[model samples]
Target: MQPWETRLEEFIAQQYGLSFDTLTKAIGKGPRAASKLAQRLKKTGRAEVARVDCGSPGPWRNSANFDDPGEVPHGPLWIFSERPIAWGYLEFDPGEWRPKASTTAHLTAVTELRLALTGLDTDPRVWTSERLLRRRLKSETGRVEVHIHDAWVRDFTDADKVWAVEVELSRKFGEGRLARALSAALDAADRSELAGVLYFVRGAGLRRAVEVAATRLAHQRDVDHLPNLEIHDLDITLAQKGMRS
Candidate 1:
């Protein structure tokens, strides 16, 4: 493990009440590095290292719980950011196995995009899941409740153009379900003058599904009349290109 990563692991373990294994998993480190870092921390007597026993039965045990599917918790506990504008949680089956670290990383990517969008503009408009729903849906027929783990929106008032932006990360459903969400967003954009949609995916399979959705949206003749769609593969990092005005 890199020196900084090891140090970070130690710090998170001490500060955030996360176990060594949990810290390593949360930070997306390999087993070798994770073990090395944990050992170093133990040697320093800064924190204790213990193995996590996954004796649970569900598919989502170790990772954050976002897929309760019953009552979504409301607060800053789910949201993780330096300056958070959106809230999200890791999705997994209850009483099942824990989710992979990559799943949480995918969630972070969507959160990063939401933060980036907020930095791009400084509008007083608040971003929330409810607001996004109202701004993105028009007719009741096209309205389908999106499993929104996290979301944020900012209203831009340039030349009387109001744009509501939202980012979502989901893993339970397939491409068809995402298509339905896109349709709802499109309908909402038509009514409220939305700017675009930024959809982030964690796995390659989901990435392909999102790509297919993007292609369909791009080819749709009516899309030009609605909000634009931007698809982001969270597994990859963005290239630091020149700044845009």
Candidate 2:
């Protein structure tokens, strides 16, 4: 395993509540790279390596519960659902879990603000439901889930204007995965409802990869199908702006 890859694997295993084996599999690397990745992660001090149980079923398939429709109750604001949405429940370190709440809140606020600014009726109630935002994307390997936030304004005196937003925050994943996610979001949108795609990145080096992917995806579309793609660096300034007025 490459040093960075090992570091990433260890970091994810500790930070994201993923098992070492699971991390290795998700990372798709051999033993040497995986070992190196784990070692590198140890050096970062952002994560720790331990012999953890692989656990039962994967969180994506098992812990997610969607059968019961519920309203958004006030709390940490991890998710705000207008309606009940499916999600997985997994064990995570309380320390590492802190960022999850803030990240979700920031994204929710951005979605709402963008919609309002575009003159679309803003509904915080609907923001919690993943079902309304998530769609399946076709890929050579399989379908991947991509969440989309779309807004538009209709003028009584003029033609309607529209915009589409796509946000991705990935860790230890490759550009190919991000590309698949973006492609899925675009494919799911109605051409008439889309104005552009905003791609957000959180990991190192992945931003450049996403840029390339966005370019390639842009080429695949016709003049009308092509949505404006903009990449933003994830930083504290942007996060604070999204969170506070």
Candidate 3:
């Protein structure tokens, strides 16, 4: 791979997804540079690129109006790439477009990943969303599947910290899913698969709730414990960093 192509691939793989503008700024490329690079990557079999439009529209939206899906359809300019590039169609209905929490969570993850790489001087060799979802573990609690929204590794002074990051924009974690995630984190901690589990919540109430729930669960467990876990309000972090506007 060429130098610029390697940089682009590393950025995309670390951030999971990035918009056209972010790509341009990161690589110091012109407006059309990312598009041309992406096209070349796709044509040369070096990478796969796709545009995604997210969120559920209002009730008036109809699925039939959506363009037929086969290859990744042309949509908003938000570009996503995966390592080994998972190729397929991403379909969405046209409706009253509004930002969704899931979509924002992903963007927030990308931001955090960038912060870690730059501020912590960590390598950009982290797992993306697709790779994180593909990881699973077997424990005495049964088969624990990892659904970590995002994860990455950071280099500390002495040790490398593997962090499993969870961006919670809403308090809508179902009981089963929350339980499974808790189990998986505990398993990862116990087996030294991860260095820590971090939760970035949108509100103080949600942060407190997560802390209480995790504390209660920890009290009930004897064999496995979560010692390297942290919950922070996402809004506060953004404000502190002047990232909120």
Evaluated with lDDT, which candidate comes out highest? 3
Q: For residue 175, what is the lDDT in candidate 2?
A: 43
Report how far residue 216 has shifted in candidate 2, in Å: 2.8
lDDT of each: 0.42, 0.40, 0.53
Pairs clashing in candidate 3?
A: none
Reference-based lDDT, residue 49, model 3: 45
Which model scores highest in TM-score? 3
The TM-scores, one per candidate, come to 0.38, 0.37, 0.58
Question: Lowest summed lDDT over 10 consecutive residues: which window, candidate 1?
Answer: 81-90
Q: State model 2's lDDT.
A: 0.40
Tens-place lDDT digits, model 3, residues 107-157: 744555455345322243444343333333334564445334455454344
lDDT of 1 by residue, 1-245 (tens): 56655444332321222433334444566645655655554565543433223343323332222224553322211211111111111111112122244344343343344333442222235444332343343356755454332443544455344443434455448546776677666565655555655555556777777667656765675553334665565435222211111
Q: Rank all candidate structures by their TM-score, best first, as comma-separated numbers.
A: 3, 1, 2
lDDT of 3 at 126: 47
How does candidate 1 fare on TM-score?
0.38
Per-candidate count of clashing residue pairs (backbone under 3 Å): 11, 16, 0
